[model samples]
Target: MFLILIKLAWRNILRNKRRTIIASIAISIGLAALIFGDAFMIGMMENLIKTATDSFIGDAQIHQQEFRDTREVSMTIQELDEVGANLAKEANVQYFTRRTFAPGMIASSANRSAINLVGVQPSTEKLLSQIDDAIIGGGFFEKANEHDIVIGSKLAEILEVALGDKVVVTVVQAKSGDYFEDWFRVSGIYYFADAAMNSGMAFVRLKKAQQMLAIGPNVHEIAIKFTSTEYGQDKQVPFWKTYSQHGNEALSWTEILPQLPKVFAMSEYSKYIMGIVLFGVVIFGIINTLFMSLYERMFEFGVLRAVGTRSFGMARIVLFEAGALAVVSILLGAILGFVLTTIFANIGIDYTGNEMMGVTVQEFIYPVLTIEQFTVYPLAVFIFTIVAGLYPAWHVAKMSPVDAMRRSF
Candidate 1:
């Protein structure tokens, strides 16, 4: 009986070719919008998160218990190997890098400024941070060692220095509580595209930084990155809880950079608002199409009812028509959306050398579609389509066969 009703609905839709075509086109366009919009938003968020993680804040970081709170040079993580072994044991951990950090004074012949000096292993940092790829002038760590420095473009400008220029770095030694100085030649100039980082942060070899600070083998921090799928999962919390012992503290990106999570939440809220507005438009279009289609079929409905077809059967026919239309339209929309997203995903939208909301894109932004996006868009459209059919079906149910036939003629 259901199959027969579906067959009848199909025949009814075909009978009015122009109306069905127009209605289907409207539905297809709406569905396509939903799919594409979702893909774009999700892709954008993923890109931002990736940039944040890869550029500096990995997925998580490990530091001495009071390190982040105080930013004190004395709060160095002493048990590097033990923490590293624990991190390595975690299946989610993709990579980790050791870092020594200090607040220091960088002075050139022309200018002087206070800056955050980071000590990093060149080999590990190449895999971990975008800083290596971000060098616009001079090569990364080429002929660069403990006595060489990689400074940000803005910092270079402030110091009135260029590549190969000698600069004096001064830092307070953690153990002795006394100031020490070292001279380094600027080996590379990098532009992170972040004003704050570019102006105030510089990089050097970890051993050199430790030696300069007289901290021996102690590192101030360990940055960890997890696999892509593991990012949104609160895998860091579990790892932190398990490993945050023996004066160790694990902090996720959300913890270290609190504002980023808030930005993500705001973007999600915006997407919801956009979705509601877009879907509202779509629902209205579907309702209008369903009403027009039902009015044209009123005579046929009344004839069927007079010939002993149940009132419920009339309503069912309308619903079946809507369902069939939704299935076909959504399929077409999905295909169109997928093709469009895939094309753009490859080409990418370039916002290079520009900062949006203080977060700069490494290169270009790519649109990525997830399985959930595809599923949710079609499901939402299907539900709205069924709801759209309800009003027309209810109108048919209220009408007497005589009245329906009279009105239709």
Candidate 2:
């Protein structure tokens, strides 16, 4: 019986090809809009997180509880070796590195500026951060030389220095709390394309920074990169319990970069809001089209009913027509969406100089089409399309055959 209704519905839809085409186009466009919007938002979020994490924070970090608040060289992680051993035991940990940081001054013959001097282990840091990839000229340190340093391109431009040029870095000693200065030759100039990082930070050998700061075998931070960023939030509790003790704490990217979660959440919520607004427009289009189609058939509906066609059957025909339209439209929309997403995902959308929420994206963003995007969005539109047809279908069923037959178009 339902098959017969569907056949009748299809025949009726074919009678008004223009109306059906118009309605189908509306639904198809809506579906495509949703898919594209979701993909774009997801891509932006992924890029933001990757740039923020790989550029500096990594997936997590371990620091003295007061280190974040005070940014003092003396608040160092004293048990670096033990903490490393514990981190090694975690299955999710992919790479880890020790770093010491201080706010200091860098001076050259032509210029001077305050900078964040970071001391890093070159070998481990290569795996944990993008500092290696950020090198636009010269080379990353092959070995820990006390005099070698990597400065950001912006900093280099400011100090009027290039690779092999000497720049003096000055920092306060941890022991005496007195300032000390040393000269480092620029081995590399890196461009992360972030104004703040590029202009205000420099990297040197870990041992050299330790010596300069007068702290023996101690690091202010231990940055870690996990096998997957997805596991970072889940692993934090256990990692903290295992590694953090008195005066120390372990933090996930979300914690260390508090703005990240807010930006991510806001981006996602904005997509939903846009989707709802788009769907509202689609709903009205569907309702208007379906109503016009049904009204045009009022005389035919009356003739069918007068000839003993059940009102229930009349209603079924209208609903079946809507369902058929939705199915056809959604399928075509999905195909279009797949083609667009695949093309863009491969090529990527580059916004090299643009900053989102203060995080600079130094690379291209690749849109991701998740399983939920393919399934949930189409399903929701399909259900809503059917619901939109319900009132029109009910109107047709309520018609008195005699009155409907006499009613003019």
Candidate 3:
């Protein structure tokens, strides 16, 4: 019985090839828009995460309780070795490194700038952060080489410092109710993660920072990397709980980079808005074509009823036509979307010229190809098409055969 219905539906569709083509094209285009939009958003998010994580914070971090609230050197952790050891034991732990941050003034030949000075141990720093990869000029800081510093590219441009130029770093220390001043030279220049970090950040050796700040063996924070970034949050919870039990505070990258969630949420919202617009246009086209086809087949429907076709059977036939159209359209759309997205993923779409959230951008924008984006959009379109066909299908089912047969189109 089902096979007979399918055969009838197929024959009916073949009877009007032009209408089928039009409906299929509508569905295909709609599905393509949804898939491509989702893929583009996903790719952008991935890029954002990669750029932010590599250049600044790692997957996770451990900081002293006071440091989490106030950005002051007084919150420096004294038991660095113990915390590092505990974090290294976790199965998903990749590597960990310690850092100290202080607000200081940097002076170069061309200009003087106020920047956040990050003190890092040269060897372990690479494990925690990708500062090494972001360097566009000169080498990263070395422990043996004292009085050397790495400044962001924007900072370098502003300071007019080159690869081998000497820059001065001055910081005032408050120890035992007394103030001590210290200074160091710039050794390297680093490119910014974005415009913000570039214009106002600098890196230097931990020993050099210790010597300059006169704060020996004290670290403000420990950054951690995970073997797999996907389960970073899950892994972070237990670690934080364990550390918090011992009176130390651990922070995940999410907490440190508060803007990441907002960015992700905005992407999702934008995708939804785009999806609605695309689906509406596609549905309008498909429904208009289907309505015309149904009107043209009024006499055929009447003849079927006269020949003992039940109302339920007639409704099923109409639904079958809608479903078939949906299936064909979704398949074509999915194929086209996948091909275009794959091509774009390789070639990449550049948004460097466009300003995003008040920052000048760098690098190409690539679309992400996730299973949900490809499959879900087509399924949604199919469901909507099927549902939309119901009202028109019922209208046909209710028509009297005598009246329908007499009506002239």
Candidate 4:
């Protein structure tokens, strides 16, 4: 009977308490590592997504169909008021800001450098991006003139300009193609993890940029913050379709930074790699333990064979013993993993100000635990342990009663 085999398997492992405990611990450590590795990878990917989006790139962006390719000021978003109304009514949109970018030159008395000028509404920009918090000197649009400007600290160093210094800006008008020039006072200086941003970008008020560019209230891009970042990643979301109409294009951060999704895809392989590596060591440990246990109980196996027990029944007993060991190990490993993940989830791992591939992590990462981590991982570990017992099971079943009896002495 299966019940009799189960009882025999449990009783046999208990014969050498220390050896069984050690084997169980070995498998348990591997299972626990698998669980922890899955949790950590999930947390890190989330942090990467959050950082990529929150670092001046919103969860999603809306733009004219031809705008991104050209980077020409002429390709501004159409029906600006209608777009604003729709965004206001959309439940998924938390905050949105209008922006226009220009390739221009900024010059101070000491030096002049080519720059990318970004126009923004300071109040709404703070709601969407971390530029407000990244300021190292002065303030972001603190009740200042329409001519006020915020330049990067790196740009400031290049231009030899500081807060309160005068800088001349030059850009071509979108429609007439006539060159326009203006003077702006440097109101603030900011620092970001991206070297390009710190070295080449400057911020000025939307109103001033519009007036100078000869475009009235038309923006090249509308960056959107969503209710949840998940909505941005889900390509099937109705939000993308609804707004991606009327000669415009709507895109998630994933689409904007195509490289990030590739990196995310690569991260998925880490779980399988970790499982293989951890359980690879455990396979040998389990086999050795089972072989040792079988040899010590050779006299009992010999008596069973002599009493007319079939080979299938004997092999099944060894397999059942492996299952029992796996069950105990799974329990301990699950408990250990859950405890470690929970403790760190509360504490969180600090990775702020760390940049990778032009994106910076601006917050702490809390490990995310899911049902798959506990259920699927443990089940896989159990199956792996069962398979590891096969060779030992086969060896024990094929031996003759006389040979088993002789090995016992």
Which one wins on TM-score? Answer: 2
Please write out the lDDT profile of model 3 over residues 297-409, one tens digit for every residue.
Answer: 88989998889989888888888878888888888999989998999999999876454543334557899898897677878988888877787678778878988799643
Point to the candidate with the largest lDDT. Answer: 4
Q: In candidate 3, which residue pairs clash?
A: 149-187, 153-190, 167-186
The weakest ten consecutive residues by lDDT in model 1 span 228-237
What are the lDDT scores of the predictions, listed in order?
0.82, 0.87, 0.75, 0.89
lDDT of 1 by residue, 143-198 (tens): 74668899999999999999999999999889687998899999999997778789
Arrange candidates, best TM-score first: 2, 4, 3, 1
User: CA RMSD for every model?
Assistant: 2.7, 2.0, 2.6, 2.2
lDDT of 4 at 254: 92
Location of the lowest summed lDDT over 10 successive residues in candidate 3: 174-183
User: What is the lDDT for 71 in model 3?
Assistant: 82
- Kindly state the number of residue pairs that clash in model 2: 0
lDDT of 2 by residue, 1-409 (tens): 8778878877877888888788888888888878977887889888988998888899989999879999988999857788888888889899999999999999999999999999999999999899898898888896556799999999999999999999999999996999999999999989888898899999999999999999998999999998999877675356767667866888888888788888788878888788778878888888898888878878888988888888887788789988888887788778788888889889999887898887988889888898887799899888888888888889888889988888643
Candidate 4 runs further than 4 Å off: 407-409
Q: Which ranges of candidate 2 are over 4 A from the true structure?
A: 235-237, 308-312, 407-409
- All candidates in order of lDDT, best leading: 4, 2, 1, 3
lDDT at residue 163 of model 2 (Cα atoms): 90
lDDT of 3 at 46: 71
